[model samples]
Target chain A: MSAQDEGRPIQSSTPDGAAAIGRHAIRTEALSKDFTLHLQGGLRIPVLRDVDLAVAPGECVALAGPSGAGKSTLMRCLYGNYGAGSGHVWVRHDGRDVDITNADAREVRAVRRDTLGYVSQFLRVIPRVPTQQIVAEPLMARGVPREDAMAHAAALLSRLNLPATLHGLPPATFSGGEQQRVNLARGFAPGYPVLLLDEPTASLDAANRDVVVALIAEAKRAGTAIIGIFHDTEVRDRVADRLYEVAPLQDAA
Target chain B: MSALLTAEGLHLHFGKVAALDDVALEIHPGEVVAIVGESGSGKTTLLRVLAGMMAPQAGQVLYAGEDVHAMGEAARRRLMRSDWGFVHQNPRDGLRLRVSAGGNVGERLMAAGARHYGDIRAEATEWLKRVEIDPARIDDMPLQFSGGMQQRLQIARTLVTRPKLVFMDEPTGGLDVSVQARLLDLIRALVAELGLAVLIVTHDIAAARLLAHRMLVMRRGQVVEQGLTDRVLDDPQHPYTQLLVSSVLAA
Candidate 1:
């Protein structure tokens, strides 16, 4: 069904300016994604069924489930990393709404660049790039000046307790905890209102997990809306203002 | 009753940073000793050193009264192959992800040159059953399993070889509350049943209380406290140990 059919009005404001004042950051209705896994010669498997979710401004929602529950797939769909077979994803900005699901490749790229921040279970860091540069890339992509972005990145690293000397070094040499902090910093660098995280603290120890939890709380306080997939109970208990579980979509056989 | 592993004044250095300093520990047969500490407290380094994965700059590791560090490469390899099982904080590190559940569990036997396919498959099934994984899913890939199931599979893989000494680094680190409890119970039961000596490194005092007979608390690469688990956790002597106990208790 179309978003209008589901009673969601078409928003008229831009998402980039939506953060200044509180607004619904993510709205979805009847969202669905399907993947065909060829079994033998002519079989297909539907990975995700019709799903609906919504996140208001400054909300933190936790998604939980077993390995094949499609939690990650749902996050991918929300962040425009994957296309939905049917449904609408709306991110409201400045009283206007962007239909992320129906956007073309270039439009989706623009939406992801300006409005969405994502962190996956395994962090991907570029070789030879300083932590500052890595964290600043999102802001740079959003058209923030290089110097200002670097300053913002440095401030974030310091707040996260990353060593000053290591700021210019490659993230590969940092400890697992430090690298995760960098990934988080990059996700928040552009100040996007919507953040998507997948098992952010699964690889970290207790102390490091606490640090990331505190960061998530801080982000919410700063008015960022977060939707994350978590396997750690402590993290979900500590951070989730709301929680949902993704179950396997029934087969069409 | 014999000392299966011993460390004397173990010192490890990562560049200029001292990771372990004058550390000493001992593991005897059928005993479970837990090392408890905060992150960056050298607990993992100590375990790696004892497992012979890292060399100590000054100090000695003795395996059954022989200097393990001094052993020839072939002998050391043989000792590791026959006597030791090490579990990483992340099960993915301990498991072969691309392979099926059966292959992951059967590999240790295969590495030891157990070529009988029937025997390997039978042994893998037995181990999987031991770890509470359904035998019906033995052909599935590791990627298809849940977090707790993957960890159970890792345990099955490591224990299939029936090594005498098992070193587990945060075996329950990433599991959910109920899953962690179950996995801990499984480990405790299996350790008792097999009379396996375990040296587990963990930060959770509650887990240590449940699984360990003895406990060591480390800080800044030094062992601040070591004693029976109840004594150390109930009435910690060292300030660092006390802090750790209280922190976990508070949680």
Candidate 2:
């Protein structure tokens, strides 16, 4: 699972192939991000400042705060969608140590394809592409045969309650809830080491929400590191092993 | 203590069954009291009575020592406009479905005699930000919002006028479990910031524990128990209260 060192303080272990060293699937040391307000005469606004966080294998860390507290911004930074202005976002990917904040495009793409799963708030699939194929792309990229990938895709979609007939159709016209389920299926299909979830069940009904809750539990049990922003407290309480409160920069002491 | 609102000897009947029976309570300014009960326990009926939305068969609801049921229609309407706010279980019930998200909040401001389009729009934007909604979505219709977003918009609509007393009936009901906590946190923060007297009717005891200073337990149209939120939840004297607390914890 992970190597141990006295100074690092080895707390526990996970299943095989979880993390490279320290069992820390994700770690951010003094991470900071800021935005230039061009409309306001180039004024700079601090989004996250001097923030330190860590997520171990087999644990879910929930980001809790009021909206506009930079929760989503931090998630984007962790997934390499946004760069960190300073500090580091160290992630364990496929037995390699990758720094997401300043990683080159090729490195970021490799880590994203091989070890990270992200379910953003909205679905963005190529137009007219079959939903099943889009969901299967992750596994296929990792060298799983097309047939095997499609089979896994079908299973995951079915588990998420997506109808069988709709698998071959594009998800562009699907309802919001349906689109969200499709997004979840694709993110989970890869069985990646880490998962970044943003309001994964935001539009889902109670029944579908329970399915997602179960999925999160399974991922944690499988030793996946999960960093999620759940505006829904119930799901956070059910899945999160710990919470990291992201205070607004103005409120930081 | 000078109670801001009080109810006495409240009794109501709907067809063959009693909706509320001999209910009495008092609310002070800058306090939050939560009413918890199962469906058909007459929690909503009691809230409606205290908010002056309905009159009981025999009882008196007083606001600032004045009789609510005895007020003239215009005066009652004015009282609701100026000093009272109501948050329905469904955001659609409390919000103007056809209006823009900002327009809904603006209407409340207009009712309270705010004019000048620039100032009203600015205030609306401010309130939306306070409720954790993106101010850039101010012009969007409430119909386009998600359930959680719509509920937050409904809150901004009700509180924009700075009402002295607010009545919320299952404010966080109909929302997914994950979205409920964020809304509750916003409501709790706003309630404390404004020091608005709130009487929240909910089935969620956890929400009560988070937001309310006092707790009221209702059963079969009567007050079964009442005390401070922590005390009543920690050591329940009534069997129904004990069951309710345990059920929430079990869930």
Looking at candidate 1 chain B, the ten consecutive residues that score lowest on lDDT are B230-239
Top-TM-score structure, candidate number: 2
Model 2 regions more than 4 Å off: A1-253
TM-scores for chain A over all candidates: 0.83, 0.90
Pick out the ten consecutive residues of candidate 2 chain B with the lowest summed lDDT.
B230-239
Report lDDT per candidate.
0.78, 0.84
lDDT of 2 by residue, B1-251 (tens): 47899898999999977888788888888788899999999999999988888889999999999999999789999987899999998999988888999999999999999999999999999999998899999999999999999999989998999999999999989898868877886787688568799999999887887678677888888887775565467545456766687677633
Kindly provide the TM-score obtained by chain B of candidate 2 when compared with the true chain B. Answer: 0.97
Relative to the real complex, the DockQ score for model 2 comes to 0.01
- Provide the global lDDT of candidate 1 against the true structure: 0.78
Model 2, A115-210: lDDT tens digits are 888999988643555899879978876889889999999999998999899999989899999999999999999988899999998999998999
If you assessed candidate 2 against the hidden native complex, which CAPRI class would it receive?
Answer: incorrect
| Native A-B interface contacts kept, per candidate | 0.00, 0.00
